[model samples]
Target: MRTRIITAIVALAIFVPFVIKGGIPLTILISLLGVIAVGELLFMKKRLLVSFEALVSFVAVVVTILPNSFWRLLPAPAFLNPRTLIYLFIFLLLLTTVLSNNKLSFDDAGALSLGVLYIGFGFHFFLQARAENWMAFVFGLIIVWLTDSFAYIIGRKLGKHKLIPKISPNKTWEGSIGGTAVATIVAIIFAESTHFATHFSLFEIVLATLVLSIAGQFGDLIESALKRYFGVKDSGTLLPGHGGILDRFDSMLIVMPIIVLIGLTA
Candidate 1:
């Protein structure tokens, strides 16, 4: 518990200032995170066969970091959106179906493409959120962090029923409910008190908080599921007691994008 608290504090110390500064620094920060995530995915897969896939991943990251001009020279936006993902998968299928001499299978290509979308596009939202509204983006982040922290503490003390024992044994229904409730309350208080979110109504803030809290837990569960699927404990051991960068920011993975969408519509 002490270790997790300390880690959280240290992470906030770095993340707050970094996210607050909305510029190339933030882009680099997220790009570096994307790189770390890619490394972890490769580590998990154990074989990044098909050199073109590696090139495409690099291009995706570059398109994410650099402006549209770099990617516009080629057609790369197809990989970022969901509707076009099927086409990209089909292209990969053809590539692996013919290019490989049984060195790569359809399953391998599908998983690799999925990883790229998951990590690559996920990190892009960090850039997107920062660019949209740093204040609301920061607010959304606090909502998730508070939700996860309070949920875990409350759940540990009062959790009764298992939420999803298969994906995350530590999770509980009570904890999930507690976390969302606390997060909603915090969002209301923050919205009422803070002048930064004056543009949003209190009701909207509450709704966003509820969505973010539930999605944040799913984000954590998603990471836990991935780890369980691979039979690995943590994504990486970069943090002391927090496991890895992914473990720390798993909830952020879900929250940031939602925040971006909200900011866009709001």
Candidate 2:
């Protein structure tokens, strides 16, 4: 717990500054995070296969996150868009699998491709959300953090029914409910206390909060599933108590994309 608190403090120290200075600094910070996350995903596989997948994932993330202006500055053709790059990398992974004579199975190829797209696109949306509205981004982060914290605390104290014992044994239905309730209250308070209510209707704010909170929980479960599949406890040991970049930001990964989508339509 002490380690977790310390890590959170240190993370906020670095994160808050970049968030406030949201420009090249934020871009660079997020890009580095994306790279590290991709590296951790690739590290799930054997060492021999890690290099190829890591390189491909890194390229995919860079393509996804780079601004249109950056692409324009390059003399590359119009076909060099993010979608094309992702598909091309997937194709290459498939080819590598074939050439390896079954050393890399179809499952491995598919997993690698999915990892690249998932991690890359997740950060892509995160960058978009931050670019769209820093306040909204901060709000989303608060919701995710509070949900996770409340769930842990409440679950450990009063939880009985297992939410998903197969995926995450520690999580409980009571915890999930408590977390969502607390997060929703926070959202309401945040809306009333800040300018969020003025920009968004009360209904829209409530709906977005509910969706983000639930999505955040599911996101954590999804990461837990991935770790389980990889036969690992944590994604990486980069963060003392939190685990890795993915472990730390799994909720944000899902929340950011949903928030961006909601922001677009709302």
The whole-model lDDT of each prediction reads 0.72, 0.82
Q: How would you encode candidate 2's per-residue C-alpha lDDT over 1-266 as one tens digit per residue? A: 89999998998898889988877788788888888887787777653434675677687777777655566678889897767887898888798788888687888778877777777678777877777777787788889989999999999999999999999999999999999999999977887687753768787788878888999999999999999999999998888898999998899888988888776323
- What is the alpha-carbon lDDT of model 2 when measured against the actual structure? 0.82
lDDT string, candidate 1, 1-266, tens digits: 79878887897798778877767777777777776775666566666634665555544544444423334466555566433543565476458646886566666667666666676656777667767666666677777878888888999999989999999998898888998898888777766776566777767777777888899888999999989988889987777788877787788878877777677324
State the displacement of the C-alpha of residue 205, model 1, in Å, after optimal TM-score superposition: 2.5
Q: How close is candidate 2 to the true structure, as a TM-score?
A: 0.92
Q: Per model, state how many residue pairs clash.
A: 0, 0
Per-prediction CA RMSD (Å): 4.0, 2.0
**TM-score of each predicted structure versus truth:** 0.82, 0.92
